[model samples]
Target: MTVNIPQLRAFLAVVEAGGFSAAAADLGMSQSAVSHAVASLERELAAPLLVRSAPVRPTALGERVLPYARTALTAVRSLEEVAADAAGAMTGTVRLASTPTVSQGLVPQLLRHWREELPRITVRGFEGDSAEVAQWLENGTADAAILIDPPPGPGVQLALDGYRALLPRDHPLAGEAAVDIRDLADDAFLISPNGCEARVREIHRLAGVPFAPAHRVRDLATLISMVQAGIGVTVLSEVSRPLVPCDLVLLPVEPRTSRRLVLSGPRARRWHPAVRALAESAAGRLAAVS
Candidate 1:
């Protein structure tokens, strides 16, 4: 038998508000109707959901069922929102999060072109490390994101950027065609505190070198500045090369590894219109690339 939403709502309201009379007042229904709704729900489930108490309370079954009822109702509400967005020429704020490189190299151009498609929709952007971008998407702070090294399932791969070595111009290995991961073992390793640590460490492990990070900085520009001062070496994606300063040299890393640029949204909001648009825009842009 189907669970009646009105009856389920009534039961939850009574339990939450601590009395049927209060729930009835809050729901704008008569006390008798509220009681009948709960009663009807109990009958459908063949279970006793409420305790006939002084202030009213939930039975053991009611406590167990409350969370599922809330989840199902939340899903229904989200579906309604999706249907509403898709029904019209969508117009609303679309929040996006992305790594600093993509934020600089990709979004501005995309935003300029995107306005032509959904003229009324405003695109708001958040720039962060890939880790922070993913966190924003997961926590509902963003409608969509361009993430690097994304987890497999939730994202669509848009581009691939290989890891490259960032070295000081005067360093002994600066002119080398390629840098082996193990060659920099004794050198101080500057790293971005906000992102890419895991991948860097994995390469160190593969090269049988102990992982040692010398300077940890969140700002990419500052990190490159430190490299210019001969502070340490680091690895970053090739996509960030254009932003690199002249004093630093980027060499291809041996045993090549790549970071993926992916467009994704919250796992729960997979069908969100803004996220769908982001996926479409990213794919179309990549397709134009040689």
Candidate 2:
């Protein structure tokens, strides 16, 4: 049976918007029109696609069909745009997944360059932990990922970046030219919620000391805030140092813990031009900061 686009749109709208009237409002059609479209879709498929209630719920058949409908619509839109671009036209979509700290710190600079250099390319950003970033890249949810301490995965490319230590300006170690991991062993540790635990533990193990975190934070901003409040000192990549406000001093850490910023995709060379461009730009930016 031929499924109509209008009917599919209405069905997806109701599934997204929860009720017939809300979907109608969003689609700028009357509630009756929305209802009729869903009915037509159900009739054509010879099944009840949705359960009518206070909030409309999708039937098993509806659940099965919804993703296909969404994917078809997305593919159609992408193809139409690609056709409009034709040959020699630089235009496509690039989805990037990165850790939250990088998302708040390094991504803005990269995105600024991307918008200027490739305005036609659509960019989507996902912020998560290293594990989540790696999962998205492996599962094909993201075209590329920026991560710290990412797990070993096939097709992943890694770049070594410099490190920074977040400490209160008045702290004794702040007066030193550079702080060493061993010097801070006695100090309370403030750790990044993601990947920091493992990295810190490894650093302690190497220093022959046991590591314990005094505070754990998910966001770079929060981690800096905690450090500024004298909660504890934490180490972060140099790229994230700029994200912290001036009230907190980010000192260079000596014998720096080498941090890896990983970039992964289905294939490094086969990535979309926009994705490749952004990845190169990110690497360059990090290198300059380092």
Best by TM-score: 2
TM values, all candidates:
0.65, 0.68
Which residue pairs collide, candidate 1? none
Clashes of 2: 0
lDDT of 1 by residue, 207-278 (tens): 778888878998888888888888888998787787788888999987677878877877765556655665
Which residue segments of model 2 deviate by more than 4 Å?
Answer: 1-86, 149-159, 268-270, 277-290
Expressed as tens digits, the lDDT of each residue in 1-290 for candidate 2 is 87888898799879867899988876779999999999999999999999998799999999999888776655554464456445645566777888877787667777887788678877777777777777756544566777665557533334565676778888888877788778887778888767456665666677676677887777667777888888889887777766777767777775557677776554422455556555665556666667
lDDT of each: 0.78, 0.73
